[model samples]
Target: MMHKPEFISPDWPAPANVKALQTTRAGGFSTGNYASLNLGDHVKDNPLHVAHNRQSLSPFLPTEPVWLQQVHGIRVIDASTSSCIETADASFSTRKEVVCVTMTADCLPVLLCDEAGSVVAAIHAGWRSLCDGVIEATVNAMPVEAAQLMAWLGPAIGPDAFEVGGEVRAQFIAQDAQAETAFRPQGDKWLGDLYTIARQRLNTLGIHQIYGGGRCTFNEPDTFFSFRRDGDTGRMATMIWLE
Candidate 1:
């Protein structure tokens, strides 16, 4: 029997038809640094295990998720009409059962849906993508107003663990001075709070109903895979779809 992959259900009050799931580094056939439940096929994990890991999610999902070749950019695709493995950082869908998914290790994975449950999106928000406005791009692609949208941030490298050089911080501050508040000086580098930066971006877009941020992949090795902490590691998938 296949072990059921452990999932973290977002606690946000999304409408009944908007479904989402966050995978952890548990319950799969992967081994070594990949450990188990490593869904990312690009990370050098055994292709068969990666395939099995994704297959384990089949019973829970409405359909096979529209996976992306994330380049940490601002591209957002319509999952309902996209081809397989589109090179994009985010994807959203209005059609029912068209699952949109983003894989992440230390980088943040954000799931979004409107209050009416008419649309859904999954974003891969690494610092570069977030600073470059991936969230904005995803929001723009959705048919609903930002005010009607709610977001749930999945496990990511926390503020204390996500150390970055000054240039990375500068890029964010260049976009919006408010981004400065999301970082704290740590010696010559800065500890960035991805959750804070995500919230700031969401709030600016009129999406104030945000939830789920404290979980840290770097801090919880038993539960998540952190590329920063483990140079060679697995990736977790975050999925969302409208029923």
Candidate 2:
């Protein structure tokens, strides 16, 4: 059977050697709540089903993707040498055929590559990681010039649906006063624009070439897994590699 993969390419002009893909919550052998194509092994899904699902994705990737433990912190691991699930939110690799991957439900997955395709990275940016500087950490870990780097924002909770408390807003506001613009008043709560905040962070790091931030996982249940929508949903994977 052929597996159908949903992928988005960054709009910026990247080197022909760079390749990337984002998987949707479709086309797999998982059952029940997972249903199909659930890539997260730690999400209470059956290990056998999860293994089968991963095997299905292997043909599309050059090699096994470097999966992270994802502690929602700013550490960026060097995938070329890391063996274990490094406690980090982002990972970078200059080695060809080693895929850098990030798993997310509502959290944003940001893929990065330079103009020359010499390096590639995958970031798991939830509110905490985004506010604490995961994007900045990824950029700093890369050897490529910031101006030459391009990014693609993957599916995430839309601003209209991502309601948060004042403390969440304060976390970002404390980082950059201008971050307040990404939040909109919603009664006693605030609707946060994760995409806009990510863009601002990248722009501050000098990575202006960015794309693919319009997808809303929370609303698109058929195509994506949303943690905010379904508390125990499976995760979708966003992967990047240099060919």
Q: Candidates' lDDT values, in order?
A: 0.95, 0.90
Cα lDDT of model 1 by residue, 1-243, tens digit:
567899999999999999899999999889999989999999889999999999999999988999999999999999999998999999999999999999999999999999899999999999999999999999999999999999999999999899999999999999989999999999999999999999999999999999999999999999999999999999999999988
lDDT of 2 at 174: 100
Model 2 Cα lDDT, one tens digit per residue, 65-135: 88899888899999989987777899999999889999999999999999888999999999999999999
Q: Give the TM-score of candidate 2.
A: 0.97
Error of 2 at 205 (Å): 1.0
User: TM-score of every model?
Assistant: 0.98, 0.97
Candidate 1 runs further than 4 Å off:
none
Collision count for each candidate, in order:
0, 0
